[model samples]
Target: MREIREFEERLQVENTSGEIPGFLHLYTGQEAIAVGVCEHLSDIDYIGSTHRGHGHCIAKGCDLNGMMAEIYGKETGLCRGKGGSMHIADLERGMLGANAIVGGASPLAVGAALSARTLGTGGVSVAFTGDGGSNQGLVFEAMNMAVVLQLPVIFVFENNGYGEATGHDYAVGSRDIAGRAAGFGLPAVKVDGTDFFAVHEAMGTAVERARSGQGPSVIEAVAMRWRGHFEGDAMLYRAEGEVAELRANKDPLTLFLQRVEGQVLQEDIEAIDRQVAAAIDEAVERARAANPPSAEQVLTDVYVSY
Candidate 1:
C-alpha cells in the first residue's frame, strides 16, 4: 500500500511536469490489483499491461527511472522514448509492453503461455486487462484458446467500474465478469480489488492452478479508478461524490495498511515511502536532463536490411 501511494505520487509529479508526451493514464485506485497479482509471480513469469499500466510496471519491478524517462520521451527511456507512455516495454523483466490498443495484450500473453507449455518451462503468463477490454472479442478468443490448450496463463480482469468515461455497467453486458469465464470451461473467482488480501489470495489460487497445469483461470478484481480515465479528463460522467466516497471507503492502499498494521511496522512502511519519493524525484530529474530521441533514429528501427 505504501509503495502504491508512492507510485501514485510519482505519477502525479510526472503528469504535472507538462512534459509527458502523448496519452497519460493514471492507476491511482487500482494499485492492489497489480501488486496483489505480481506478489506470486517471479521474473520468469510474464505479464502484459494496458495503457493504465504504470502501476503494473512498478509492481512488476520495472525501473522507476526508465519508466519516468519513457513518459518524458527521453532517449534513455525503456523504449528509447518512441513508445512514450502507452507502449513501454522491458522484455528482461517479463513485461511484454503496455498496449495502447484495448484488449491487445491478452492474445500475446496466451502465446507466451503456449510457448512456456510447449517448451516445458515452469514459467506462467498473466494477462492484465480492464473491464473495457474484457468486452473485446480478443479476450474471449484468448480465454478459449488458453482453456483448450491448458496453457499456463492467468487472466486478470481488473474491473474498475468504468471504461474510460463510460460505465462498465453500460458497456459490459454481463453482471459478473467471472461468470463469463465459466463459458470458457475454466474456474473463476471474483474478488474485491481494493482489499490486498482478497486479491492476493485469489491470485495465489489462480497462479497455482495455472502452474500446476490445472488450466487457465479468470480473476475478476472489482475495483474503482480513483483518478479520471486519463490525466486531463473532466470526469463529468462520474456521479457527484462517487470518487470521494470510494477513496474514503474503498481505497486499496488504505485497506492494505489496515490489514497489515501489525505485521509491518509503521516506521518500515514510512521508510519505503521516503525511499520511493526519493526515487521518483531522481527519476524526474534524470528525465528532465536527458535528451530526446534523434530524428534519424526513428527511421533506423522501422526497417530490416532496407
Candidate 2:
C-alpha cells in the first residue's frame, strides 16, 4: 500500500512539473484494493486493469523503473514507452494491460478467463473497473458472458466514490454495483476498500470460488480516490473540504499501519517507507535520464498482423 501511495504521489508531482506527459491518473487513496487482492494472485492468474492503473501494475509485480519510464515515455519502459500510464502490460506477469477506455478491459479479462478455462490452466482472471465504468454496456455484457460461460473471472469494481468528477451515487443507475452483479448470477460482495483485511478476505473467497470452478464472482471495493480523476482536473464538482476529510479520516495507508501496529514493528514500517521513497526517487531519476522512443518505434507495438 505504501509503495502504491508513494508511486502515485510522485506521479502527481512529476505530471505537474511536465516531466510526465499525457493523461495520468493516480491510484492515491485506493492502495489496499490492489495490494490486498493481488497478494493472492500469481503469474498463472491474470488481471485486466482500468485507466487509473498504476496501483494494479505495482501490486501485480511490474517493475517500478519500467513503470516510471513508461509514464515518462522513455524507451526502456514496460511498453517500450508506448503505452504510457494507462496501458502498462506484461504478459508474463499476468497483467493483461491497463485500458484507457472505461470498462474496456472487462471483456479482455473475460477473454483471458475463457482461455484459462479452455486450456485447463486453473488461472483466474480479474477485471478492475471503476464505479463510472460499471455503468457501461460493455461491463454488463462482460459480466453476463462470464456467468453464462462459467468463466474463472472476478469482476473487481473499485468503486472509488466518484467516476471522474461524478459521484457514484449520482451516476450508477442501480446505485449498487454489487446488487447489479448479483442480478447477473455472480456471487457478489461489497468490501471496505480502505480496509486491507476486508478486501483481502473477500477477494480470497472470490478467487477460491473461481479457481474451484464455481464460476465468476464480483467484489465491489468501495475505495475513494484522494485526487481528481486525472491530474489536471479542477475537481470543482466536489464539496469544499471533502477531499481533505477523506485524506484525514480515510487514508488506507495510515489505517493499515494503525491496524497492524503490533504485528509490524514501527521501525520496520519506517524502514519500508524510506526504501519505497528512495526507490521512487531512483525511478524518477532513471526515467529523466532515459531516452524517449524515436519515430521508427511508433508503429512497432501497435498492431500484430497475421
Candidate 3:
C-alpha cells in the first residue's frame, strides 16, 4: 500500500513539474481494494483494471522499474512506453491491461473467464470497475452472460463516490451497486473497502465460488479517491475539505496498520516502509535516466506486417 501511494505521489510531483508526458489518472486512496483482492490471486488468476490502475499493476506483481519507466514514457517500460499509465499490461502475470474507457474491461474479463472455463484451467477472472462503470450497459451485459455461462468471473466495483466529478448519488440509479446483482442471479455483497481484512475475506469467498464453477459474484468496495479524476483537475465540484477529512481520519493504510498493530513488529513494518520507499526512489531514478522509444519503433507495434 505504501509503495502504491509513493508511486502516485511521485507521479503527481513529476506531472506537476511537467516531467511526465500525457494525462495521468492516479490511484491514491484505493490501495486496499487492489492489494486485498490480489492477495487471493495467483499468476494464473486474471484481473482487468481501470484508468487509475497503478495499484492494480503493482499488486499483480508487475515490475516496479518497468511500470515507472512506462509512466515516464521510456523504452524500458512494460509496453516499451507505448501503453503509458492507462494501458499497462503483463499477460504473463494475469493482468489484462488497464483500459482508459470506463467499464471497458468488463467484456475482457468475461472473455478471460470463458476461456478459463473452456480450457478447464480452474483460474478466475476479475473485473475491477469504478462506481461510474457500474452504470455502463456493457458491464451489465457481461454480468448476465457470465451468469448464464457460469464463468469464473468476479466483478469488483470500486465505488469511490465520483464519476470524473459527478457524485454517485447523482449518477447511479441503484441504491447500492451490489443490489442490482440480484436481477442476474449472482451473489452480491458490499464491504468496507478501506478495511483490507474485509476485502480479503469477501474476495476469498468469491474466488472459491468461481473456482468451483459457481459463476460470477459482484463486490462493491466503498472507498474514496484522494486525488481528483486526473492530476491537473482543480476539483471544484467536490465539497471543501472532503478529501482532507478522509486523508486525516479514514486512510486505509492507517486503518490497516492499526488493525495489525499487535500482530507485527513496529520495526519490521518500518523496515518494510523504508525498503518500499527506497525501491520507489530507485524506480523513479531509473525511469528518469531511461530513454524514450526510438522513432523506428513507432509504427512497429501498431500493425502486423504479415
Candidate 4:
C-alpha cells in the first residue's frame, strides 16, 4: 500500500514538472482496493486494469522501474515507450494491460477467465473498473456473460463517488452496485475500500469460490479517489470540503496502520515507507536517464505482418 501511494505521489510531482508525458490518472486513495484483492492472487492469476492503473499494476507485482519508465515514455518501459500511462502491459506477469476506454477491462477479464476455465488452469481473472465503468453497457454484458458461462472472474467496481467529474449518485441508475450484481444472480458484496482487511476478506471468499468453480462474483469497493479524474482536472464538481473529509476520515493508509498498530511495529512501517520512497526515487532517476524509443523501433510493435 505504501508502495502504490508513494509511487503515485512521486508521479504527481514528476508529471507536474513536465518529466512524465501524457494524461495521468493517479490512484491516490484507492490503493487498498488493489492491494487487498491482489493479496489473494498469484503469478498465474490474471487481472485487467483501468486507465488509472498504476496501483493495480504495482499490487500485481509489475516492476516499478518498467512502469515508471513506461509512464515517462522511455525505451526501456513495459511497452517499449509506446503505450504510456493508460496502456502498460506485462503479459508475463499476468496483467493483461490497462485500458483507456471505459468498460474495456470487463470483457478482457471475461476472455481471460474463459481461457482459464477452458484450459483448467485453476486461475482467476479480475476486472478493476471505476464507478463510471460500472454503468457501461459492455460491463453489464460482460457480467451477464460471466454468469452464463460460470467463468472465474471477479468484477471489482471501485466506486470512488464519481464517474470522472459526474457524481455516481447522478449517474448510476441503481445507485447500488452490489445490489445490481446480486440482481444478476451472482454473489455480490460491498466492502469499505479504505479498510484493507474488509476488502481482503471479501476477496478471499470470492477467490475461493472462483478457484472452486463456483463462478464469478462482484465486489464493490466503496472508496475515495483523493485526486481529480486526471492530474490536471480541477474537480469543480465536488462540493467544498468533500475531498478534505475523505482524506481526514477515510484515509486507507492511516486506517490500515491503526488496525495493525499492535500487531506490527510502527518502526517497521516507517522503514517500509522509507524503502518505498527511495525505490520510487530510483525509478524516477532511471526513467529520466533512459532514452525515448528510436524512430527505427517505432513501427515494430505496431503491426503484425503475418
Candidate 5:
C-alpha cells in the first residue's frame, strides 16, 4: 500500500509539474482490494484493470521503473511508451492492461478465462471494474457468458461510491452490485475494501472456485477513492469534506495498521516502510532520467506484416 501511495504521489507531482504528458486515473484509496485479490494470483493468471489501475499493476508485480516510465512516456516504459498511464499492459506478467473506456476490459478477462478453460491451463482471470462500470451492458454480457461456459473468472467490483464524478446511488439502479450476480447464476460476495484481511479471505474463496472449475463469481469491494476520477478533476460532485473525512478515518492503510498493531512490531513496519520508500524514490529517479520515445517509433508498433 505504501508503494502504491508513493507511486501515485509521484504521478500527482509529475502531472501537476508538467513532467507527465497524459491524464492519469490514480489508485489512491482502493489499494487493499487489488492487493488482497492479487495475493492469490500467479503470473499464469490474468487480470484486466480499469482506468484507476496503478495499484493492480503493482500488486501483480509489474516493474515499478517500467510502469513509472510508461506514465512518463519514456522509451524505457513497459509498452515502449506507447500505452501511457491508462493503457499500460504486460502480457508476460498476466496484466491484460488498464482500459480507458468504461468497463472495456470485462470481455477481455472473459476471453482470457475462456481460453484458459479450453487450453486446460488451470488459470483464472479477474476483471476489475468500478461501480459505474458494473452498470455497463458489456459487463453483464461477460458475466452471463462466463456462467454459461463455467469459465474461470472472477468479476471484482471496486464499489468506491462514485463512478467518475457521479455517485453510485445516483447512477446505479441496483441496491447492491454483487446481488446482481445471483441473477446471472453466479455466487456473489461483498467485502469491506477498507479491511485487507476481509478482502483477502473473500478473494481466496473466489479464486479457488474459479480454479476448481466452479465457474465465475462476483466480489464487490466497498471502498472509496481519495482522488477524483482523473487528475485535475475538481470533484464538485462529492460532498464537501467527505473525502477528507474518509481519508482520516477510513483509510485502508490506517485500518490495516490498527488491525495488526499488536501482532506486528512497530520497528518491523517502519523498516518495510523505509524499504518501499527508497525503492519508489529510485523508480522515480530512473523514470526522470529516461528518454521519451522518438517520433520514428510511433509507426513501429502500430502495424504488423503478414
Candidate 6:
C-alpha cells in the first residue's frame, strides 16, 4: 500500500505540474483492485487497461521510468511520445495499452483471450473497465462472447461510483453490476475494492474458473476515486468533503499500511517511498532530455508493407 501511495503521489505531482499532457485520470483510491488482481497473474497473461491505468501498469511490472516518461510525452516513453497519456502501451509486458474510449478495451480483451484459446497458448486476458463503462453495450457483448467461446478471461469492473462527472446510480439502472453478468450465464462476485485480500481471493476464484475451461467471470470491485475524474475537474457534482473523507478514512493505501504494519516494518515502507521517489525523479530527467518524434515518423508506421 505504501508503494501504491508513492506512485499516486508521484502521479499527482506530474498532473499538477502539467508534466503529463492532455487528460490525467487518477487511480488514487483504487489501488487494491489492480494490486490484488495482478498478484495472481503471470507475465504471459494480458491485461487491457482503462483511462485510469497507472496502477494496473505498475502492478503488472511495467517500468516506472518508462511510464513516467510516456506520460510526459517524451521520445524515451513507451510509445515514443506519440501515444501520450491516454494510449501508453507496452506489448512485451502484455499490457494492451490504456483505452481512451469507454468500454473500448472490453472486446479487445475478449479477442485476445479467443486468440490464446485458438493458439492453445494457455494465456488468459483480463479487462479492467470502470463502473461507467459497465453500461456500454460492448461490455455485454464481450461477456456473452466469452461465455460462448469459453475463453480464459476475467472481467474486472472497478465501480468507482462515478463515470466522469455522472454518478453510477444515475447512469446505470442496475443496482448491482456483477448481477448483470449472471444473465449471460457466467459466474460473478463482488468485493470491496479497498481490501487487497478480498480482491485477491475473488480473483483467484475467477482465474481458476477461467483456466479450467469454465468460461469467464465478472468481478465487481466497488471503490471510490480520491481525485476528480481528471486533473482539472472542478467536481461541482460531488459533495463537499467527499473526496477528503474517502482519502482520510477509506484510502486503500492507508488501510493496507494499517493491516501490514505489524508484519512489515516502518523502515521497509520508508525504503520503498525513497526508491519510488528517486525513480520518478530520474524518469523526469530522462524524459526532459529525450527528443520528440519527428514529423515524418507519424506517417511511417501506418502501413505494413506499402
Error of 2 at 154 (Å): 0.3
Clashes of each: 0, 0, 0, 0, 0, 0
Across 1-306, the per-residue lDDT of candidate 3 in tens digits comes to: 888988888888888777788889988888999999999998998999999899999999999999999988999999999999999999999999989989999999999999998898889999999999999999999999999998999999999999999999889887689998668899999999898999999999999999987889999999999899998899999999999999998798999999998999999999998999899999999999999999988886666676
**TM-score of each predicted structure versus truth:** 0.96, 0.97, 0.98, 0.98, 0.97, 0.95
- Cα shift from native, residue 202, model 6 (Å): 0.5
Off by over 4 Å in 2: 304-306
- lDDT, each prediction: 0.87, 0.93, 0.92, 0.93, 0.91, 0.85
Name the candidate that leads on lDDT: 4
Candidate 3 structure lDDT: 0.92
The lowest-lDDT stretch of 10 consecutive residues in candidate 6 is: 297-306
**Candidates ranked by lDDT:** 4, 2, 3, 5, 1, 6
Expressed as tens digits, the lDDT of each residue in 177-250 for candidate 6 is 99887889889999999999899999999888877788899999998988889887889999988988897888
lDDT of 1 by residue, 88-134 (tens): 89988999999998988899999999988889889999999999999
Q: Model 5: per-residue lDDT, tens digit, 1-306?
A: 888888888788878878888889988888899999999999999999998899999999899999998998899999999899999999999999999988988899999999998998999999999999999999999999999999999999999999987898888787689887779999999999988999999999999899988999999999989898899999988889998999998899999999988999999999988998898888888888999888888878766666
lDDT of the structure predicted as candidate 6: 0.85
Which residue pairs of candidate 2 clash? none
lDDT-better candidate, 1 vs 3? 3
With a 3 Å backbone cut-off (N, CA, C), the pairs that clash in candidate 6 are none
Tell how far residue 303 is off in model 4, in angstroms: 2.5
Compared with the true structure, the alpha-carbon lDDT of candidate 5 equals 0.91
